[model samples]
Target: MTRRDMILAAFVATLWGVNFVVIDWGMSGIPPLLFVAIRFVLVAALVVVVPRPAASWRTIVGVGLFMSLGQFGLLYTSMALGLQPGLAALLLQAQAVFTVVIAAGVLRERPTTAQLVGVVIATAGLGIVAAGRGGDAPVLAVCLALAAALSWAVGNVISRRAGTVSGRGPLGALSLTVWSALVVPVPALALAVVVDGPEAIATGLAAFGWRPLLSTLYTAVLCTVVGYAIFNGLLARNRSAAVVPWVLLAPVVAMISAALLLGQIPTPAEAIGGVILVVGVLVTSVRRRGRSEFSLRVSRSASRSRVSAPVAETARAAD
Candidate 1:
């Protein structure tokens, strides 16, 4: 990647990482689903006002269904149920492994040996995180968080299938956000009505001050709009394999934010687990690179052998 692309990726990672903190902040004031729905509404409005190229409304809504509705609906429910923002951010990286698995199965893209190992190591790390949840989290909250991860994986697969249809620039995410506003809000509101009720929504709206709203706006504008725009644009320019490693950096930013802002003091096991996860990601990436080099070498050698075989046969015949 170019220096500019690297820098932009860093910026995107940091913004997305810290978004956990914003989600936590907003959760205090507003119900998670309501907050998310409102954020998407604002995002949709922003897209409508800014104006962009033509895209099939169908394609736009499809992207939105997965990215916004599927992903955030699960995410908000998870956070509301008591999953820590920091941990939620960390676990979501599981999407990378899930994507690898999905690609191999659905796209018929084989994973490198290194990636397979990375998958195992990351899986172990997740097991550790899950085991830790027994005491630290509510049973239902853990389930909700896992649900969020699954939803995100589903969305990733859908995005892989969708491939950027012409005219749906990054602003196309707004189309998804609009659909999110329409599709997700109903369920979120329904849940709120059931769990908290109409009065609860009314109270949330009335008591809702600017602080949580602003945080939601930041999530919609900076994290969703700018971050997705930059990352997706880079994905368009480069391979997903090349672009995804940059996201591993996101956990680092999430850890730092959690420690500094939330005053989360990690236990020794958690710290060790974090290191293991990082190392696993690096190991997987290196393994893939080595395999790529070996494949290229084999391909060239085969080509040379094919070219030389006929020459040798011709020479033998001449003799």
Candidate 2:
């Protein structure tokens, strides 16, 4: 990936990391499913003025289903079920591993060895984070978070493929983000009704406070609109392998923010694991300088081979 896009990805990760804190802070009394539906309703509202992306509705629907609805729906539910915010952030990163593996099998986009190793190392760091910050999270909650990760990976592939189609430029990333959201609100609301029950939804609406509204605004504008817009563009421009690893930075940001802002200090093991995650991302994102140099050498050798046979023969005789 180019340095510019790499920086963009890191910035997005930072915003998202901070977003976890915001979501945790605000979602006090709201039912999780209703909250998910509310946020996406805000997002889907963008379709009124925003230009539609140059993609089929099928692609748009797929992205919306997996990326927006499926991922966040599962994620918010997991937290509602008692997963810690910090652990939830780390668990969601399983998408990076799932993304690379799935892209390799389905999209034929093989990850480099460095990427595979980096993903493994980062995953190990997540395990350490879990150990360092032990909690009695429910098993079902953990499973839901992992399922959210898988949903996010599927969404990444869909968006990547959509971008590769002709006419779907980086500009279309914003469009896709907005347009795909159209498919989210209804299904998400329906799920909310089914899961949260009608009375809970009414109570949540009745007690809806400024905090949730602010959280919705932050998520709708920064995390979803700005963050995913740039993320989708980066994935379009670079390989999935190159793009996904930077997400490892997010947990580091999340833990640090939690410590500073929320007074939830990390154990030494957690700090060490955060450092390891950063190292893994760096390894995965190393420039392909060696491959470029090797190509140059091959070209030089080919040039020498293209020299006239008689001239080479005479030169050899002289030597």
Candidate 3:
């Protein structure tokens, strides 16, 4: 990757990391679900100008359902219920583990030994967090953040499957992000109505002021539109191995920012578990890259040396 892309990746990670603080500040006096509706309303409006992705509507809507609606709805609600910004950022990355497990079951993509080990390690970290949450981080709030991670993982699979519906990995990822957003607003608003009621909704709308407006603009424009655009572009230009690790910086940024700005610091258990969780994600991602590289080498050898199909299959099995 070029220096420019590296800078851009860090920039995106910073924005995403700081987003928890932004959300906490912005949602004051507003219903969490309603905030989701309002934010997605701006995001969905981009469909008027941006072209639709190459994926089918079902794929798009499925991505929207889990990625946008389910993930953010639970996330915002969890924060409102008092999960700290840094911890929420850390816990949400459980999606990395969830994504691997779900893909193994639903897509029949068996994980490598390294990945399985990583999953166990990450789960151990989660157990630690659960046991040590204490009073500051409510159990229900932690569960909701975890549920958000699970939802995000499901969405990740759906988006990945869409890329392969025609047997490809590369995709019109930014377009899909924009188009799928069309599925978020109405459902979020309806959920807000159900959860918060008409009076709260009315009050939330009335409470919409500078902070919320700034939050909407930053999230919709910088985080969703520009951030995804740069990220997808980087993936298109670079190896997934090179691109993915930069994401590790996000939780670090979140934790540091929360500590400095919000006066929120992780408890010892939370810190230890967060570190383990990050290590697990790093191991999984690195092994995945190794697998891809090995596959590439095998494919090249088979093409050059006329490797027999059975020999190739046996080698793959051994791998």
Candidate 2 lDDT over 240-303, as tens digits, reads 8889989989888988888888886777877888888888898898764334333455555646
lDDT of 1 by residue, 218-282 (tens): 88889876776676555543334444545655765776788899997555555566666666656
Q: Rank the candidates by TM-score, best first.
A: 2, 3, 1
Q: What is the lDDT of every predicted structure here?
A: 0.63, 0.83, 0.75
Which parts of model 2 have CA positions greater than 4 angstroms off? 166-169, 290-319
- Tell me each candidate's TM-score: 0.78, 0.89, 0.80
Candidate 3: tens digits of C-alpha lDDT, residues 1-319: 5567678877887888888888888889999999998888888897887778877999889988998899999999999998888888877877766777777678665666666766667667766765676767888898999999889888766765665332122236678778888899999999999999999999999999999999888888787777765665555444333444455456667877888888887778767876776676556444243444456678678869999888776554333
Each candidate: RMSD to true structure? 7.7, 7.5, 5.2
Off by over 4 Å in 3: 1-13, 164-171, 229-249, 285-319
Model 2: lowest-lDDT 10 consecutive positions: 310-319
Clashing pairs in 1: 64-176
Query: Model 1 off-target regions past 4 Å?
Result: 1-7, 49-58, 164-187, 238-242, 284-319
